[model samples]
Target: MKKGIIYAVLAYLTWGFLPLYWRLFTAMPAWEILAQRITWSFVFVAVLVTVSRQWRRLKSVGSNRRSAAAIVLCSIFISLNWFLFIWAVNNNHVIETSLGYYMNPLISVLFAVVFLRERLSPGQWLSLFLAGLGVLIMAVQYGHIPWVAISLAVSFALYGLAKKIAKLDVLLGLAGETIVALPVALGYLFYIQSQGTGTFTSLPPFSIILLLLSGAATAMPLFWFAKSMQLLPLSFVGFFQYIAPTTSLLLAIFLFNEPFSEGNLISFSLIWLALIIYSFVTFKKSKVKVVPISRADAL
Candidate 1:
């Protein structure tokens, strides 16, 4: 249990601070960064799998049709989530990104109901109600829609659903998703360099180093998270889920100095209140649980 708590803390800390890492490559387009990320993530995880002799499992990722289709969808959505997050962080929307992560668990509950034929308890429905009101407030604040938060939440939630269906080992699943997208990523990076629009080759040495290390940044927390999930009860881990977004919320207001308006304050209050209620009800209900995914929340 202690070890699990430690792992969970480390994983959430890493994810919480990931915005700083992604922000380092401000010169590169989000698309290029994502491509590089996918490419190097594949390289990094591929090495780990080979060294751990998990290559056999990696090969089995999409053997059957359903799993194959699911893996493809996983690749697409995770890629979208990654790009959106990186873009949002760099573009000064980190607070909105935080809001999205804050909103994700609730969003996943809705996803479960609609797509998985799952039912929600009254407490769950009440949590959703407050959350929806919060989002409605945010939408009004934005004067249209809070697309960044919604997009990130929905994309990550969809990724979680697909992941639940995939049901592969976490590392294997990541490897498969990266591999599925590897060709396009590689081609795009190659083309960008060829067209003289590439940022990688011309980046400063330190920046180049960080770019290479982004793969490690991207995948290692996931391993830590998987370890924690294995060691801890789901309910315990679920409480720890907000650490990443809460960190992001802080970083946005203090470190990055993003504006946090009154509307943001009110909406976030409602969302946080809802989460508290949902979590309280959830924890009180049972020890055996099926929980929604958190930030960096893989199945």
Candidate 2:
């Protein structure tokens, strides 16, 4: 349990601090950065798969057309999520990015009800209502929809749904998706290079190193998160999930100096309230017991 807590904390801390890492590449276009991330992430995971001897499982995924299709869909969602997040960070929309993650769990609940045909408890219904109210309040205040938050939430929710249906092991599933994305990523990088506008051509050695390290940044926390989930209850892991967005929120307010108007506070407060209610109900029903962990737990 202690090890699980430590691992979970480190995983979320890494995710929280990721904005700092991506900010180092502010000079690069989000698309290029995303291409490099997908390409190098595959390279990194390929090595891990070899070392762990998980290639057989990865091969099995390719043999199953349904699984491959699910992974392809997952890749698209994750790539979209990654690009938007990198873009949001570079564009100084960190608060909006954080709001997206804050909305993610609630969005997942809604997805479950709608697509999975799962029945929601009373607490779940109220929680969803509160979250919707929060979004509405933010829209009213900003005079525009909080599209960044909504897009992030919905894309990630869809990614989670794909993973749930695919039912592959976490590492294997990631490898599959990254492999599926690798060709397009390479093609984009090649096209950009041909245009003579790619950052790779002009970047300093240090920046190049950082770009390569994007692979580690993308995969390592996920590895730690998977390890932690293996040791902890799903409910405990769910509780820890809030740490990432909370850290992002703090970073946005203090480190990044993003705008935090009164309306933002009121909106976030409602969402937090909803999360608190949701967590309480989940814990009460699960009785803090460990269950067979699912891919949704990792998300």
Candidate 3:
């Protein structure tokens, strides 16, 4: 448990620092960032799988038609989420982006109830209500729904839901997603190259290395997260997920010097309150037992 918690914290901390790392690439378009993330992540994962002798496991995911399809779908959604998130960070929308992630855990709970028909305790339900209200308040403040936040939260939640059912090992599953998107990423890079606008060729050597290196940055946290999840309870891992956004919020305010408007303050406060209620409620309830099941039922 200690090791798992440590790993989870490290993963979140790495993810939290990601905005600062990607900020260096602000001069490049988000599309280029997305493409590089895909391409480099592919390389990094391929190496890991090879060294760990997980290559045979890759065949298992590929052979499972339903799982393979689900992974491909997850890849698409994750790609979109990564692109939007990187764009938000690079374009000075980090705080808003952080807000979206602040809402993500709540969204995941909603997705569970709606799609998986999972039951939410009354406290959980109330937490969801508070979170929704927070988002609505933010939307009203902005004079429109913050669709970027909605998109990031919903897409990522769905991706998690699909991964739950797919039952592929994390490394293989992520590899599948990258492989599915590889063609598109490569084509985009090539198209940009043909047009003499390629990030790889046009950028300075250091910048190019950074862009490529971002792939390692991209894969490492995920690799750590996958291992941590395997070692920890889903409940604990869920809470740890919030650290990334919280970090982003601090980075936005302190490091990037983004203005936190009155609306942002109120919205952020509500979000923090909602999460506090939800976390406390969840932690308390996890200690209670509503039912007992046989050994086979555990599966």
Per-residue lDDT tens digits of candidate 1, residues 250-291? 898999998888997898788788778877776566545557
- Write one digit per residue (lDDT tens) for candidate 2, span 178-227: 99999999999999899888888688998898888889899888667666
Which residue ranges in model 3 land beyond 4 Å of their true spot? Answer: 1-8, 227-239, 289-299
Stretch of 10 with least lDDT, candidate 2: 232-241
The stretch of ten residues in a row with the least summed lDDT in candidate 3 is 230-239
Report model 2's TM-score to 2 decimal places.
Answer: 0.85
Ranking by lDDT: 2, 1, 3
Candidate with better TM-score, 1 vs 3 = 3
* Cα error, candidate 1, residue 152 (Å): 1.2
Q: Estimate each model's TM-score.
A: 0.85, 0.85, 0.87
lDDT of each: 0.80, 0.80, 0.78
Residue-by-residue lDDT tens digits, candidate 3, 40-68? 99998888889889888888778888988
